[model samples]
Target: MSAASEKSTGLRIVTVPVPLSGRPCEASASSLGEILALFKIGCLLKVTGNQVLAPLDGTITDIDSSQLSVKLKADNGLQLWIKVSEVSLQGHGAGCFTRVKVKDRVKAAEVLFQFNPAMLKLAGALPFARVIITNGQKIERFETTKARQCLAFEDTLFTLYV
Candidate 1:
């Protein structure tokens, strides 16, 4: 095994929560650095309805564009940034609702906000979901062919070694 993979360590597994409840339309396993540079997450869960739920138990750190985007600090020390819709819904945070304010403690699977992806799409916005961990890299992932597999809410998204 390569030196990186040879090092012994513990594993941290995080399951997918709601809002990302829909079937995984597309997913790409990538390094945290690459994810940051893209400004777009590798996985896009295709949701049909509007109601969005929290992916993990965390505190709301920040919100923007009238609640279309949010930053959360997961209880496990994972900082997550979520974008509800595409740029079309940027300035106009229509079809979006803010359920919790900054500093609010939320539980896993809690309702964070409600939105209508269909409306955004009608307005030329590519209605989808993107999640990323905005933190310095320390955790490493070990995934093979299953890395790109579709995921559902509550499913094991991936396993991490720390």
Candidate 2:
């Protein structure tokens, strides 16, 4: 469905945070068990691009010391968590450059972090950006896009019914 329909249906749509040229897969408990088990449902987007963007308008709530993860709280009260790389590669010369800090307000499509995909791959990291809805329990209906491929800020990543 289109964002235009969101007003009528009382739904909120969140688009892909980063440009994805590789693939997009469902984030499951098994896949993220090592990272964050709190992510019971989310999306794992292959990191073909070096930069990660804001999925929606939100305030930077928290950022990990290793610069591998960031948490945002959208204006609509939806909480999102984004991880740059695999847990195994954290602080092992993964070379992630984070742009925002806690309490910073961000607009959709704004650059949040930059990293080297090649460097991550060479270090045996999967190079996937994990986007998790931290406050997913508050959502009544959560529908994720089936598209295996997506473009930044253009394709819908998921929709939430509150």
Candidate 3:
């Protein structure tokens, strides 16, 4: 099916994967700012594998393919204005962090990248990615397509509906 066909209905949630070098922390806080603050120095992030899934997913309503950012029409009529260029990379790990590009097909439950929990702890912040809906609209009702990490759309790192 085309990427558009993979769009999840309001009743279901898609399970995006954790893109990182090492296995992601199960108990890690879910905030991007927190993650950055933890790494005081240039964090030792890892660019390891090609994770098949992305934590973010939605119908590609509008896109700046050249820029990699896309405007998505979410189930609740809320639009997510995401820029691929702004997407953060995972740091503080073993190898170099692989920079992901737009249109690179990803999957849920797959590793997107890895960060150093130790560095984050030392930096005194958390590496958590928070999805903000600029539209200022709220979704009413919906169910997750995946059961476990498959999160209900609100924009999460892994198991997200990118």
Q: Which candidate has the highest TM-score of all? A: 2
Off by over 4 Å in 3: 1-53, 56-96, 132-138, 142-162
Rank by lDDT, highest first: 2, 1, 3
Give per-residue CA lDDT, model 2, range 1-162, as digits (tens). 666777788876543344333367545533543444555457777666777678889899998736477888988777888776664455436776778889999998888777778877786667677777877786667766777677766777776666
lDDT of each: 0.59, 0.69, 0.33
lDDT of 3 by residue, 41-125 (tens): 1111122222222334434455343333334444444444433222332342322233344344433333333334344445443
Model 3's TM-score against the true structure:
0.32
Candidate 2 accuracy as lDDT = 0.69
Question: Which residues of candidate 1, in runs, are more than 4 Å off?
Answer: 1-8, 16-18, 25-42, 65-67, 88-93, 142-152
lDDT of 3: 0.33
Q: Report the number of the highest-lDDT candidate.
A: 2
Sorted by TM-score, highest first, which candidate order results? Answer: 2, 1, 3
Pitting candidate 1 against candidate 2, the one with the higher TM-score is: 2
In candidate 1, the residue pairs with backbone N, CA or C atoms under 3 Å apart (3 or more residues apart, or in different chains) clash, namely: none
